[model samples]
Target: MDRITPRQALRMVVIAATALCFLMPLYWLTISALRPEADIFRFLNPFGPWTLIPNQLTADNIVGLWSGSFSRAIVNSIVVALVTVIAGLMVCASAAFALAVIEFPGRGVVFTTMIVSFLIPFDAIAVPLYSIMRGFNLQNSYAGLVLPGIGNGLAVFLLRQFFQGIPKELREAAMVDGMGWFRIFWSIYLPLSRPALVSAALIMFIFQWQAYLWPLLIAPSNDMKVAAVALAQFSSAYNVSFGLIFAGAAFLSLIPMLIFVFFQQYFTSSVAATGSKE
Candidate 1:
C-alpha cells in the first residue's frame, strides 16, 4: 500500500482549497436560489454553513421565473444560441479550411488580422455594430441576434489550427482521386475534425448565450429579450427580486455547464491538439 508523504498531503490540501474557492460562488448561487428571498443574505456578514446550505428550500423562485418574460427570454436565447452555433460552425469551418488547406495570397496576414480582431474587446465595436444592424433593418429580430455570433473569430482560429493539424497526405490523396475542395472538406475533414467542431460549436454557443450588451442594443423589445438581458432587467425593476435573479442565473448557467461536461473530452483534445500543432 502507498502512504502519503507530508509533501503529497499538503499538495492534496492545496488542491482541495483551490477547488473550493472556484466552486464556492456556484454553491452560493444554488443555495441563494433555493432559499427564501429574505433569507438569501442573512448569513453574508458572518458567513457560516447557512451561507451555502439554506435552512428551508423552496421552488417558488424557480417557478416564478417561468411566470414572467423570463420564460420567453430563455426560449429566445436557446433559439439564438442554437442558430449561432449551427451558422457559426459552417462559417468558421469554411474559413478554417480555406486558411489551413488552400494555397492563397496573404493567408498569414488574414489569419493574423482575424486573431487580432478577437483580441479587441467586442464591447469596443458594439456601438458601430449596432448601427450596422440597424442599417440592415435587422433590429428587434432574431437575425440581428444570430448574425454577430456567427462570425466568431476565436472559433475560426480554433478550427483553423485543428484543420492544419490534419495530415496533408490525406488531402493530396483525395485530390488525386479527383475529389473537389468542397467535397474533401465536407466528406473528409469534417468527419475527422469532430473534436474541433464540437469545441468551435461550444465557443459560438457560449458567445450568443451570454450575450448582454449586443442583445440589449439590437433587440431591446420585451418580445425579443434574451435571458442575460432579462436577468439584468430583474435587478432594475421597481422591486428587485434577488431570488428570481439568482434562479434565472442558475438556470442560465446549467445549459453551458452540462454542454461542456458532456463535450469536455472533445474540447480538451481539440485545444491540446491545437497547442501542439501551433
Candidate 2:
C-alpha cells in the first residue's frame, strides 16, 4: 500500500539498467546460436528492420557439435568435475576436521602454514608441477588432471571455519558413546554441515569445469580435452564456424547455469550458514 519515494525509484532504475548490461551479451549469444549465418552478420540492424524469420532457425550446429568430439568432451568434463568435487571435499573435510577439532603441539602453526599457502599463485608453480607430472608419466592422463586440484587450501580453510563453529559438547557426547573420529565425522559433523559442503562443492565444480589453461597444458590430445578446451579449438583460425562456436559456447554455458538453477537453494543456505557462524 506504500508509495515509492524518488530515491527508491532511482535505485530501481539503476538496478534494472545493471541487469540489462549483464544480460545483453548472454541474449546475443543465444540469438546468434539460433540464427542462421546470414542473420549473425546483420546483427547490427535495429529491432524494427531486423526481421527474424522462424524458418531460418536451425539446430544443425547443435546436431553437428553433438556428433563430433564435443560429445566426448562433455562426458570428460563431467567426469573430471565430479571427480574433483568428491576428492576435494573428502580431503578438505578431513583436513578441516583435524585442524578444527583435534589439538596437537604444532596445530596452530600448521593451520597458519596452510592458510599462507593459499596466497601462492598456482601459475607461478606450473613449470615445477608439469615436471612432476612428467616424472610420474601422468601427462595427458585423467588422474593427472584430477590429482592436482584435490587439495585446495581455500576449501580446507572455509570448511575448517565452519567445522570450528560446531559445538564441542556434541562431539564430546559422541566420543563418550564410543563413536570414533570417522563415525563422528560422517554421522554428525558432515550431516550438520551440508550447506557449507554443498556451497564448497558447487564452487569447486565450476572452477574445475571451466578450467582452460591447466587442462590445455596437461591434456592436449582430443581424447583428453574438456569442453572449455574444445571450445578454444572450435574457435581457432583454421576452423572458424561461427554458428558451431556459438552453439558449443552456449552448450558449455548451460551446464553451469543448470547447476546453479537446480542447486541454488542449497548454495544460498550454505552461504547463510557460513555468515551465521561468523
Candidate 3:
C-alpha cells in the first residue's frame, strides 16, 4: 500500500474522531454497568477517573437485571420485534411490488395515501386502535403487540422506491412466460431485492424494539410488558437506582447491536443502492 498522504491522514483523523464520539457513550454505559453503585456516583460528572476503568468491577447489577422480571420482558421484546420484522416485510414488500410493477387506476392514490399516513404518528390513532383491538379481544396478546406495527408506511415507501429501481423487462419477460404476478414477485423480484428487504426489516426491527407507548397502552400487564416498558418500571417515587437501570439498558442494547452486526453487509448494500434506480 502507498504511504498515507497529509490529506488522507487528516481525513483519517476526522473519521476516528466521529467514531469515538459515538463509541464514548457506549463505553461509559458498559463501564457504569460493570461498576458498583458507590463507585458510579463518586463524581458529579459521570466521566471521572472512578468510572473510566471501573477498578471495583462487579457483576451484581447484570446478574440482578438478567435474573428478574426484566428477563421475561427481554424475551417478550424479542418475540415482538421478530414478529414485527417478519410481518412488516411480507406486507410492505407485497404492497411495494404491486405499486412498483402492477398497473392500476387508483395505484397513485393508494401510494399517496400511504405516504400521508407516515405523517400521522401512532399516538393519533392509539385510542381508536385500542378500541378495535379490544373489540377483537386481542389486548395483552402477541397478536395485539404485532398487528399495530405491520406494514409500516415508511417501510412500504422505501421498499417501493427500491422496487422501482428494477428493470421493467424482467417483469415483462416473466409475464410473457405466463407466470402470474405472485410468481414473478416471488422468483424474479424477491430474490433480487434482498438488500431492500433487509433494509426494511432492520428499520421495522428497530422501530418495534424501541416501542414503548403502544405496548404500554395495549399490553400493560407484567406478563405482556416489553423491555422498553419494563425499563420504566424500574423507576419509582422512592427509588432511582442508576446501577440496575443502566445494566438493564446496557443488556437491552446488546440485541440490536448483535442484529446490526449480523446485517451489516446487507445494510451497507441497501444504503448504497437507495437512489440508484435503473
Candidate that scores best on lDDT: 1
CA lDDT scores, all candidates in order: 0.90, 0.83, 0.87
Give candidate 2 regions above 4 Å deviation.
Answer: 1-10, 45-55, 267-278
What digit string (tens of lDDT, one per residue) describes model 3 on residues 116-224?
9888888779889899999999989999999878969999999999989999998888889999999999999999988878878888987888788889888989999
Score residue 210 of candidate 1 by CA lDDT: 74
Cand. 2 TM to true fold: 0.88
Distance from true location, Cα of 139 in model 3, Å: 2.4
Q: Write the per-residue lDDT of candidate 2 for residues 1-278, one digit (tens) a residue.
A: 29999999999999999998997777677767787865676745666444433336788878887998889988888899999999999998999999999887899898888888778877677778888998999988899889877888888888999999999999999999999999999999999888778877876887788688888888888898888888888777496888888888888788888988888887677678799999
TM-score of each: 0.88, 0.88, 0.89
Give me the displacement of residue 61 in model 2, in angstroms: 1.1
Regions more than 4 Å wrong, model 1: 1-6, 105-113, 267-278
Q: Considering lDDT, which of the candidate structures 1 and 3 is the better prediction for this target?
A: 1
Residue 91's lDDT in candidate 3: 94
